[model samples]
Target: MPSASRIAILGAGALGQQMAQHLRQQGRRVAGFFDDTCPSATTAEGRVLGPLAAVATEFAAGRFDELLLGIGYRHMARRQQVFDELRADGIPFGQFIHPSAFVDASVQLGPGVFISPGCVLDLNVTLAANVLLYTGCLVAHDTFIGAHSLLAPGVRLAGQVAVGERCFLGIGTTVIDSLALGADVRTGGGSVVTRNLPEPGTYVGVPARRLR
Candidate 1:
């Protein structure tokens, strides 16, 4: 279990607000949000605490013990940058598993993982740190999702699939069994990945083909 029961969200966008609600429903306290755009403002979830610049100070003052990076897939680089900065500042990250999600006991999960509502992770699945599985996503048995990968809503990974770091599977994308996708791969919405994608690039279509 994580040491902190309270979490401070790092973004105040739609996903951030949704995460706040989910965390609250899980019985964890939502300290507030840290967003530059909405500094000192009130959100539907809670108050916008301040900009990212205030993180180290607030953390040192014990305002919140853990952080959830609520930035979306479009800003993957920013997410990684902020995570690195906070990690270097000795700020801990928290994992948020929605109450409706199903994760097998044998599954291995790393720090800062977020599994959204109705998502399922099968037995022996391994999700590395900061992996994000949005609503209704399914990761089958023995699958491996690398660090900072994002699986959009309803994305499905068949058994034994391996998704590399910083990959993004768009909404409703499906990857068949035993496939492997290299780092930084991006699949368009509703695409079906039928084979191993060893190179990093954007893909789309019924049988996913590199677009760029």
Candidate 2:
């Protein structure tokens, strides 16, 4: 959002609080949060305005400039749902790229992307909407991560790799060049993917194998 400054976060859980902290660190003001679980009160980062339903109304009232999703990887469905619904309703989202991260000039990021500290995104790397990359992850050239994908800390993807939507690459996972991972694929921590994963399932081990 080019004109957005005050960002509102959805889901006031641990992720929400952490996002708020990073936003503040980036000198961006948080307009508060909207959550079903937390009461409408002061949280550690900001106040909880109301439920998710209250977002459009509040936005129309000029309460916040943009929105960001704090929904975690454990609930990919909910995260995607909230993002798609809110975005369809004309609520724009803001991205949070931590200061310590290095993104090349050719990298393309979609809305509501969160890049944590020390991450490196090389040339032509494309991260789709609502993609979250945790600390120290590295994406090589021409890598395309699809929408709603979550990459855990220290994940390394080589050149020309394509990761599908709603995929979760666990901590320290590594993928070689030119491979494609299908939608809804989940990899265990330290998994090394050397070939294309064409189906949706959980994979693990050095040379990643699908879990039975």
Candidate 3:
């Protein structure tokens, strides 16, 4: 069993609180939260640490070695900003995979990645930093998920699929084998990607055509 370590979860939203609960269950101590604006005194979590600007300083001062990003906003731009800031700060992010997840031994996961419950990752799958795989999603063999991408619940990626940086695959979406997605692309819920996507925009529907 891995010993408990000190960790700080950024963003005190619903996801953050849920992450805190899970980490605590794993015997990791959560040292409050780091948020720009403090919520109510009595929050889902006890207290907020401080503003976002203070994050790097706090991390450098040895406040926490690991950071879990729990903010689940839809906008990809905002997500990029947060990711970049964290990297610039030089704080190593922690990857959180639920105890129930089935990750293959050959799979490579980067820091700050989060895999929710019941997710299945096959052999030789590589997930870059800050990627999020929601519950029940499956990444097949030889798949590469780039940095800052989010795979929603039940999203399925076939073998040799290459998802670019900052992409968002909505709930129940499925990508056929060997397909590729460009950076900053967003797919609608239940979309089926049958071809390679190059331009960045909102994609929707079965067969997964671009909407924007």
Q: Judged by lDDT, which candidate is best? A: 2
What TM value does model 3 have?
0.92
Best by TM-score: 2
- By TM-score rank, best first, the candidates go 2, 1, 3
* Residue 22 local lDDT, model 2: 83
Off by over 4 Å in 3: 39-42
Which pairs of residues collide in model 2? Answer: none
Local distance difference test scores for all models: 0.91, 0.93, 0.84
Model 2: how far residue 145 lies from native, Å: 0.3
Tell me each candidate's TM-score. 0.95, 0.96, 0.92
- lDDT: worst 10-residue window of model 2: 1-10
Q: Which has the better TM-score: candidate 1, or candidate 2? A: 2
For model 2, residues 1-212, the per-residue Cα lDDT tens digits are 22348999998998899888988877889999999887587898999999999999999999999999988889987888889999999999988888799999999999999999999999999999999998899999999999999999999999999999999999999999999999999999999999999999999999999999
Span of 10 residues, lowest total lDDT, candidate 1: 1-10
Q: Which stretches of candidate 2 lie over 4 Å from their true place?
A: 1-4
Residue 35 Cα positional deviation in candidate 1, in Å, after optimal superposition: 1.0
